[model samples]
Target: DPSHIAGKREYLYEISQKAFDMGMEGLMIESHYNPSLALSDANQQLTPADLSKLLDKLVIRYQYANNPEFENQLELLRNRIDSIDSELLEILASRAEIVRQIGKYKKEHNVTALQINRWSQLMENRIKLGEKLNLSEVLIKTFFQLIHEDSVRMQTEIMNS
Candidate 1:
């Protein structure tokens, strides 16, 4: 598919460079002793000599941890990300706990999980807040729908159990 270009060789080189840029190990290139005489897909085949030249032109960089400065910066950033991820999980868990309690209360009152008016109110209020926070309405809707679905499933399980 990548070979579907004017210059197949150049396409391969470009693809190789992009792969390297995007933290890929390497590209799987088809090499032939003689490209023109190749039996199958000759157009997409690279001569060994050409492959060697392309390899030479490429600058393969080490992983981020190779340099101490880079490693330190990456570690700091990753640690911050880890902390943020932990906080996100904690928030979700807290929400789940509340949903669990709600399930119990609804059961006690002999109410079903599908509280349409309550769901609509929540969606409307949260969507407004999400808009104020500069979030896309579509994104907010999707996220809340997923959370609502999660709550419904968990509540159903709790109710039945």
Candidate 2:
């Protein structure tokens, strides 16, 4: 879903301008017909007619400019990223099942729901590996935090009996 802070058109405009200045081709705006009837993002979705009007206004001000080489490079990078993203999703699904197994085992062993120390160690090791692979530390940390939180919740549910 696309999101921008509301009641801050100036801020959003500045951000969009910065992206253009940084060589982005254009913005990918989400538009829908009868946004009020949307199942999701009812508040954010714009009617198709309104969106068209907005795009017309924006197109007059924004020029389409890009280095020819940039498109090829971007396509190559996108392909590589898509491949890795598929693998990552598979691995995450496997990890979720493994967490479920761990929850069951912990129940049998009468262990406490969460092993925070072990989770901390796991995160530290993962961040180290991520660093070796050139991933941003902040991104790695945030990913692990969400995964750990969800895994703990799963474990908690199993332990509650």
lDDT of each: 0.85, 0.73
Residue 115, candidate 1: alpha-carbon lDDT: 91
What's the lDDT of the predicted structure labeled candidate 2?
Answer: 0.73
The regions of model 1 sitting more than 4 angstroms off are: 1-68
If scored against the real structure, what TM-score would every candidate get?
Answer: 0.55, 0.56
User: Candidate 1 residues 79-145, lDDT tens each?
Assistant: 9999999999999999999999999988888899889999999999999999999999999999999
For residues 1-161, write the lDDT of model 2, one tens digit per residue: 12354322323344555566666676654556776676765665566776665555552233443777877887899999999999999999999999989999999999987787998799899999999999999999999989989998898898786
RMSD of each: 6.2, 10.4
Q: How far is candidate 1 from the true structure (C-alpha RMSD, Å)?
A: 6.2
Displacement of residue 78 (Cα, Å) in model 2 is 1.2
lDDT of 1: 0.85
